[model samples]
Target chain A: MADHEHKDNEQLGAAGFNRRGLLKCMAWAGTGVLWTVNGGVPRSLGLLGEAAAAESHAGGLTFLQISDSHVGFDKPANPNALGTFQEAIAKIKAMPTQPAFIVHTGDITHLSKDKEFDDADQAMKALKQKVHVIPGEHDVADADNGKAYLDRYGKGTQGRGWYSFDAGGVHFIALINVFNFQPGFKSAGLAQLGDEQLEWMEKDVKGLSSSTPIVVLAHLPLWTVYENWGWGTEDAPRALGYLKRFGSVTVLNGHIHQIQQKIEGNVSFHTARSTAFPQPAPGSAPAPGPMKVPAEQLHSVLGVRTVNYIRGKSPLAIVDTPLSA
Target chain B: MLRTRAVLLGGAALSAMLCAAAPAVISGGGPALAAAKAASVKIDNFNFTPPTLVVEPGTTVTWTNADDSPHSVREMDGRFKSAALDTDDSFSQTFSAPGQYQYFCSIHPRMVGKIIVQPAGKTSSN
Candidate 1:
């Protein structure tokens, strides 16, 4: 993708275009444009803007998203989740190109046992890259205040394990909405980002320019995919409001252990497949849980997602590759 | 004289009395057979088999996790709560108060169940 600002300027030199006219010009360019405001005026940049602009200095940024490892689970769906988890890691190891890091959305274990965490830790260590993890309900089912999870993955996170970081000119926010869930509904309970975290999130993004790409990571879906199964977050709208100003937003989650995607305006929502086992599609079964599949077909549904960031062209370019595929 | 002759010849009145008593026998000696009341709600397929149950005020209700996943029973109004129960694990609560108590699994909220406790000494018909 190429920037046409200088060429377009020559053609429209004395015309003095309005906002609508500029957008029309952007469309005419036939390329994804990243729009930013400078000095109270809107300007468009070429596809693969800043992130790719530095390809010579540092390679193009790429990250792997893996979730629902369920290390200790021993069920018919996938009797040895640990074995499949190793397969997932092997797939990452065999990738022709390496990702900068791996973000584990949640559910690193079936039960938050020390051995489970240890198995997950040893498996993830094989990748040899930084692994960022948030907790799923299963990880905290045995520990109060998430002491067990915190001891492993919650080193610098604040208030139930939510934090943000900057990588390759893109902002990534890791949130925890699985705590204090309202019980008896279904699945993971309608996810919630409490008042304290929501307040912190608003201030966190207050200083970011709208052009910066924002990636929100949590265990449960931020939007209402299926409330009856507690597959949605209750107060995600409040958290989303803080992100409205950003030009690009991508939300990633993994409690459902299926591949689901949604795009709303400038925001895109994606739930990755599990490395442990497959779950039935929403409403396809009586409820969401370990969906036993034919032994041969087990690997076809569980895998990891690789996201490539091209600056001006909507930083989130997600490609899901199953263990078999 | 005609009624006496009919009863002696066919025994129709006695048969009718036995016919009426058959249902009572099948229903386990009427509602007074308190030992046979359904007092447990089996949680399987992520649901409460009998979504609603009725029993005497002093009856104890047991919820068993028959599914392979973990679950918990929690009262909607904060009256009772259970810890995370793995497969085959069970939790029980006795309803001494005569009222409706709604509860759900904390792990799977949609799996809701209701228990109606009748007044003291009253047993629910199966």
Candidate 2:
């Protein structure tokens, strides 16, 4: 495998970039899971040293990130959504340091059925912890109608489903971009925070100090993943512009299903993994949908990321460690 | 251990009744299924495409290589594995039993999918 370390400037063709060892990029096969690694090293994120662990890190926070947990989805690609989701939770519980809270980026359910939500909810219930949620396109198909998912999960959130909270002196914002969408943009899939919510988000963070650590969670990549497939958000530019001033901003999204990252200034953006099944790389397949794999080895993909916010002069650390590892 | 579902539809198997989605002929609805058309799934970033699929019993589910890279289609217990299929190459398996088959690219287990197999010669439940 090459250096497992993901190089910002170096680009791996969306598909079949030869990687040695376990660092190889996972691809979509028949009815099985593929583990695809970019370059070699899965991003070597910096961890905060001393001073921050003693709780004196005041605005210090570490949280678990789980995305694309497509519950109620029963496919050869991923036969067991509940089990994988549990595995993901187990990874979260086994974290070296327990995060202050948990964030589910999106795709909590595959078909977005009530039972699917319940299944995901059941798995989460075992954690015995408070969870913050942001809806993905799968969860908010009926926004034009009262069936908007925000109504069910958007407690104390803003706009259709965007909301902000304060923890450890840092401002945590969750936005809903699955609202308005355009055609051929299926990659980013259709994220919209409604004008009402976007306006509110601007005002909500207007007064916060640029130094305060900000964690933003949405469903789609705020940046571009694959322009051909619309693998990025249409309106994220405006949203990022708002956070550009913040010295340490961490933006997280879930739509891509793969882990891709980029650091633009103080902002570190990451895409999360799904608790359900894995998808193929953009353009690697004919079209986007549930990918199939063999029946076994499904657990390897069930991983979680831990983000630790430390005080002092150190920047916040985000780790995408897989549960299957 | 990975899990697979084996659901017995409650209603009669007469008409092809699709549920929760469009009234299309097929696309993984109900406890039933259909044969899968050979296709490729996207996995460059970290997701599956057509994340769900339903096929009739005995349908050979083939995952082809559409990208320049190589990939596999294997089961959880090492029950199956596809030698890396290069670009344009393909792999296939016949789903004979009526049950849910969840699989992933052994190379990249995160690339997951589900294949719901239905009882042969049946569709809707009334």
Judge candidate 1 at residue A211 and give its lDDT.
Answer: 87
Per-prediction DockQ: 0.22, 0.02
Q: Which 10 consecutive positions of candidate 2 chain A have the poorest summed lDDT? A: A29-38
Q: Write the per-residue lDDT of candidate 1 for residues A1-325, one digit (tens) a residue.
A: 0123234333323323353344343222222223222211223232323452224113456888999999988888888999999999999998767888999999998867789899999998899789989988788765243578888887888877889999877899999876667655334457678999999999899999998888899998898777767888889999988888777788899998876555566676778889988876666677898988888878867888776675555435455666775
True contact recovery of candidate 1: 0.40
Error of 2 at A44 (Å): 1.1
Docking quality tier of model 2? incorrect
**Per-residue lDDT tens digits of candidate 2, residues A239-297?**
88888787777788888776666656666677766667666666767655556555554
Kindly report which residue stretches of model 2 are placed more than 4 angstroms away from their true locations once superposed. Answer: A1-60, A142-148, A185-190, B1-126
Candidate that would win on DockQ: 1
The TM-score of candidate 1 is: 0.71
DockQ of 2: 0.02
- lDDT accuracy of residue A26 in candidate 1: 29
